[model samples]
Target: MKLDLIEPNAHYDMAHGKPAVLEYDNDGSWLYRLNIEPEMGIPEGQQEETQIGWKCYEVRGYNKATKENVKKVVIRSVIDETAEFDLVNSYNKHVLGIAVNESAVEEYKEYLQFTEDLDAVLIEDLSN
Candidate 1:
């Protein structure tokens, strides 16, 4: 499955030109960080050295009229996919800089497992 990066909250901002972030929420956001050298392709199922990024924030569900709400989830960073690093496109791609979410952080075990699973599927595709 091709992954897509999801931008976080409105209050956040991207700075440093390196993709690092500054969070303003009282409850921290989960971050998922990845640094991809577009010019250099990554192996499937292997964790690459993509610049670290974070995903934080709770997706909540609330009653429409009353506005009563509850925190549904606290997700650390979402996946980052600004460029493709496949073999065919490898030569054309450039390893620019890295990216970070100014909004959130990742849940440790959850992020680890998520990345592992993502790597497995992506690797299989890359091999073919």
Candidate 2:
């Protein structure tokens, strides 16, 4: 599958806890696994905003078929989209056993679902 075909926010199975592998290609030459990764951090120029964080949705290509490998190197490309810092920080805080407001929780949930949907579309496109 072409890495550029992946959308900005791909939908995935949240119930599964992690983004599912969208595609795997082994054509005797190389192995490729495509999937979305949600990461937390402030972007380079936005580092001064301490209360803010970002949930970066990246389409990562791995050399291995599974993520269980000790050194999972990305061999293809990474397409990323950055969201509001508060939304990501809320999600991160919740994961880190911190308390967030009700609205923050809902916002983060919505963001996650949106990204998952994006993934679902990419997976379908690759299959076709």
Candidate 3:
């Protein structure tokens, strides 16, 4: 699986909350997960306009699978799109907490990037 980010947004919010807005592109569409405070802030505006930081991915070969894509196929098969999003939302709040200061924006972005890079690494390993 050559995992390219289709779209990603993770943040610490006080109101409508979630830690990460994770979207995976599959079946020619995108499935999203909002991992933040359940009651944090609303997701408003475009990716660049809002305080939210977004990540976009480009999947290499979803329809056409190869030995390299096996891990991605397995992971996606195991992960239930909707359920994982809910779980992440709850877990992120429990573990990371809500936004306290303006620094949260940068912090959340960095955190999300780290996790995302981990995901990329996993995909690369499987692809190789």
Candidate 4:
């Protein structure tokens, strides 16, 4: 999956340079984080690392269970052509219940909004 690092909400501002945030509702859900790095490789006869060709996008999420942080999803690539389609399909499949007219708390509404916004951006990026 090609994952893009995005500031989905004002809370992201508090993350400083690190793109990290508790999944919008802040109900001790998953903490989403992004890491961008140059794909590096050592050239023959060279002792230094060099950028191979592409920038790697790593999307990671962690959940706090008890007192330990449990790793959740860790997507390694976010630039694949099919990423957007796959994401939308998966989201629809998994969150269809919530996406419908379901009663939810205010915090859950905020979380839905965040997901919607993120989806919009991903769709936009795909179109471009």
Candidate 5:
């Protein structure tokens, strides 16, 4: 029920004022890619837009000691009293910007299906 999310190795594109970046390991290994977004909440007055903000989000990465990627959305580490389900908030870019453990991707997919209002989820291939 409760899963832990991994943070990325590093970030970039922080020059002026851009969305915070979550970098990944580039050692030519298999890494799970996930395209995620918030369930819904475009605000009542704002016109529908395509981009997402970077204020709230999380990425799952390995801790080095284990050298394993975290493929599932962390079920814990959430304490929002008003949220419908436990979640890892992240920008729902039109891209697969988040990475998880290769094995946990499926588990994350299954878990996401049960949750409503979330943005469309996409799983990326490691070979790519």
Candidate 6:
């Protein structure tokens, strides 16, 4: 399938953890993976922050009018809107992680800021 990014080069962080590590490749591109846990999925209560994910996706359908595959990338703060902000939730999806187009790095970073804002708003509620 053909793919394109609305926001390509943004950097993001997990509120409970450190920022996502961006690895640069010789080809001048970057990538990051969303890991669930070291072992069993449970809170370790460690000082180190885990970088949860805010995945971007593309939805596709057959366009009868154009006889082409209609595609759309879904950019969201998290996979689920009503679902609580949890690492597990982010982990299940985006397992393959995200690869950014060098040109879109700035937009990619800005797009990822949603996590920072979301975590700030839910901090108190999450503490309970």
Candidate whose lDDT is highest: 2
The clash tally of candidate 1 reads 35
**Candidate 5 lDDT, tens digit per residue, 1-128?**
22224333322222423332233557532233233222333645787753332223454555431212333332222333334232332222212556434445444455565332122222222323
TM-score-best of 3 and 5: 3
Cα deviation at 34, candidate 2, in Å, is: 19
How close to the true structure is residue 2 of candidate 6, measured as C-alpha lDDT?
15
List clashing residue pairs in candidate 2: 10-115, 10-118, 10-119, 11-115, 11-116, 11-117, 11-118, 11-119, 12-116
- What is residue 117's positional error in candidate 2, in angstroms? 1.2
What lDDT score is found at residue 99 in candidate 3?
27
Choose 1 or 5, whichever is better by TM-score: 5
What TM-score fits each model? 0.21, 0.31, 0.25, 0.25, 0.24, 0.21
TM-score, structure 2 vs. true: 0.31
Return the top candidate by TM-score. Answer: 2
Model 5: ten consecutive residues of lowest lDDT? 116-125
Off by over 4 Å in 1: 1-106
- What's each prediction's clash count? 35, 9, 23, 3, 12, 11
lDDT of 6 by residue, 47-108 (tens): 65444433332122222211111101122322444333343334433443553244344433
- Candidate 6 accuracy as lDDT: 0.33
Question: lDDT at 50 for candidate 3?
Answer: 41
**TM-score for candidate 1, residues paired by index:** 0.21
The local distance difference test score of model 2 is 0.45
RMSD of each: 19.7, 16.2, 17.5, 15.8, 15.4, 19.9
Instruction: Judge candidate 5 at residue 2 and give its lDDT.
Output: 21
Lowest lDDT block of 10, candidate 6: 65-74
| Alpha-carbon shift of residue 46 in model 4 (angstroms) | 0.9
> In model 4, which residue pairs have backbone atoms overlapping below 3 Å?
2-78, 2-79, 3-78
Global local distance difference test of model 4 = 0.39
Q: What C-alpha lDDT do the candidate models reach, one value each?
A: 0.31, 0.45, 0.41, 0.39, 0.34, 0.33
**What tens digits encode model 3's per-residue C-alpha lDDT throughout 1-128?**
12233232343344544323333354654332322223323366544434333332223344434433533543454345664465456555655665234444454455456457646654554344
